[model samples]
Target: MTVTWAGANARRLARQHLHPDAAATASPFAAPGDAVAAMLGAHAQVLSAAELSVGLRGDGLTRTDVRTALWTDRTLVKTFGPRGTVHLLPAADLPLWTGALSAVPTGPNPFPGNARMTPDQVEEVVAAVGDALTGAELTIDELSDEVVARTGPWAGDLVMPGFQAMWPRWRQVLHLAGHRGALAYAPNRGRKATYTNPGCTPLPGTGALPALIGRYLYAYGPATPAHFARWLAAPKRWAAEQFAAQAASGAIEEVAFGEAGPAWVVAGDTDVPDAPLRGVRLLPYFDAFAIASAPRERLFPGAAWERALGGGQAGNFPVLLVDGVVAGVWHQRRSGRRIAVTVEPLKPLSGARLRDLEEQVERVAAIMEGTAELTVGPVTVGPHA
Candidate 1:
């Protein structure tokens, strides 16, 4: 039997706890870790956006709550995740992420010979990084000094491009070290961010990918190997092989996904809701829903395809969702105790949707700890940095 996008969307929204009724009374998540685990990980390259991404899905969670979960309770760890980008993942799941990510073959190095490290050198740096951050936090510069001290002068060569400056060659393995559970973000020191070791051992790669794939399907099911490949930036052939091997072992199964054709879901998770999700949501840039949902054309139909997406990328601009589809673009600007919210709807909203939009704005402002003024007009700001 074929599954409709409606069914897929309903399952995904419910799994992510983004369904309309998920906000009523109590939260489904016991803590920020539960929320982070629900979506695999929350994009954290833009920390504030990541906070809103997790906060909106959780009940009555403030920005401070997310911060406390990360820096205080240590329930969440900021590290390099899928596609080698910064993400906030559940601390307990570090082993899974590190193991899965380390197993994926990295793409060809973009750096020149002088800047890139050999495989052995890469291992040395990862080990040195782990050793340096074992029980203390260090800023990037401090880590560089320690890495050079431990690994020798070649490790300190200034050849890697940074913020208009050259970083040390050892910096090339920073993400790898993160994926090896040797590095994670610590609380900011004055204005500089610091790194520390999570101190968790990573599972072997062979035993981790199967579990990780099951977790992925649970959060974004009715997917394809290509979808999984795209999500992790892994090679398509590798993803297909992994999925095929899993299917042969009865870990996953395939089903028709309406017009989108054959898609895979966890073997026993084929059921879907009778009705699709319906609600008005203001999703910040790189929100998991905007990024992880597949068959992009359906999620960002018509003009939304051109406006909501940036050359097929979903997270460059914050999106306004109606009934689980991208309906508009929105931007927020804060001034003292008030926030100015500008929304540009692709189509005129009905009265009910307009009311829902206002309510959503109120929720956003509350999470932001500010009063809000909404204007449904063109958003003049450019994409976030």
Candidate 2:
């Protein structure tokens, strides 16, 4: 239907506010410095590779889409891997996107679990990895070995050191690297690329922070600072303040989140309840539209989500979106070259919803080159007995 700029702002924060230039899509790596700058803002960082990847798709484009359409080198922008991350933005966003997205987090850490090391040991590991990756790029395998050799006793050997405390700190170190411009990605990460150490630059401080937050809300809002905080994993107080500052500007608008005060948003960026909505689709696991916004249960039931996604690692599982609403959950897997996709429903889908999910799945298949099988089925439903 006719989704108003306002309603669009409210419901589709992940999609509405993010705007990577058409030029980057035209030629993603051809001196995409400007496009990147526009996309990422001043700090030039992204919070998580997966998040960036999903945001790109929500933009109606995928990482590879930017490549095929942009017809530029993939080595530079989206595929630039590691921090164990990927960013779907152009070369320019390296600055601001990092500034906005990189500095915080939500949920538990996604880093591989390794709890043997103390903070200093973790620092040593980071140092070892950074040193190996300083001039030349190295794979996680290579980096892991170096870390083991340097620190000995191998606390996180070959493992990503996924403990909760370490995860946040590691995220910061990577963010610091991105700010330094030392954060770029390696050649490939298990076939996908890794984030590089594009070098370092000083952060923009508090002033630039809110602007960065506003940009995020512009692209993804009508939510809480808690949501923003969770998304960035920044301290709660700092995140709330950032949202407030941005809200003061007419560019932001706050709406109610149940009994709470209105959540901050880019005012006209998402659903305002007064407007209609656009078409719907099945979103990927870790899709920005699904996880990026908070009161996450806003779209789905909490208990069901925990069950569907295996607790803290809610990153797994597919998401269904009908108009602006989250419809349900689904998933895809690959056996050899065969891709099997399945939809496990939380609620029964209407005929129209089923048709919509099919279309979205095809879109996903197209992204993966349609080389594998895809399927859909009910999650768990039993008698009232």
Candidate 3:
């Protein structure tokens, strides 16, 4: 069956719990942990972004609540997850994430010349990382020292053309350690962060890939093997093999998405209700809903494609959604107790939509623990715009 774009949008809104009426449901998430689980995970390249993403879903949740889950309660973990980017996942799900991610072969090291470590050296660094963080939280410098001591002095050699100054060769293994469940970001120590083991023992089996793919489809379908591969940063062939196996087992089925052609969804998910999309959300940067959806042209549409996405890079800026579709881009700036939120809409909004946007601005400010002052009009997008 061919699902119209609007039909898909409606289904997506319901699945994402973005429809306004979903807030009143009996099982509405009461905490950040519940929200994270419902969404599969929250993109967490920025901690504040993840907090806002959770707060947007859960009624009465706050940044402090998210912090409590991540730090005090330890119900959530910050680690390199889908797409090899930092994400906030429910701590209990670490085994599934680690098992699935560990199976994907590592891509070529980006660092050039002596900066690049051989596969054996990389494995040694990964092992050293596990040793360094076992039962202890250590800052990057401390972890680097431990790696150099365990692996050799070469692990500490500086590699130029790094993200910020020259980074140590050992740094390359950090994400791999997280993917392998041997490392996770610890609560901040003063102004710096540390790393620790997630403490989840992997399940003794190979069901992880199928389980993960199933969860992904449930949350982010109708997607293709290519989409899954891109989302997981796995090899296309590996994703295709997994998809084929799942399909053979009747775990997934194919359907046509309007204009986007064939896609796959978890079996039995083809009967989604056509819920009306009725809400405005100030989705923070790297919000999972926007990033997970493919056929960006349909999701963003027209000028919004350029305005909201900004050169096709997802997560560069927060987005403004009207009735589950990208309508604008927004930014927030703080000055004392007030946050100035500037929204640039690709098209004029209805009075009701404008009020919804205002309410969303208030929500954003509340997440920041400050009063909100909104400006709707021509605003330039920039690093701090």
How close to the true structure is residue 346 of candidate 2, measured as C-alpha lDDT?
58
Q: Write the per-residue lDDT of candidate 2 for residues 207-257, one digit (tens) a residue.
A: 546666666665555567777766654678877776667767776776654
Tens-place lDDT digits, model 3, residues 220-288: 788889888877777888788889989999999989977778988999888655766677878888888
**CA lDDT of each prediction against the hidden true structure:** 0.90, 0.49, 0.82
RMSD of each: 1.5, 7.9, 1.9
Ranking by TM-score: 1, 3, 2
Q: What is the lDDT of residue 251 in candidate 2?
A: 61
Ranking by lDDT: 1, 3, 2
Off by over 4 Å in 3: 24-26, 383-385
In model 2, state the lDDT of residue 75. Answer: 22
lDDT for position 119 in model 1: 86
Give the CA lDDT, 0 to 100, for residue 175 in model 2: 36
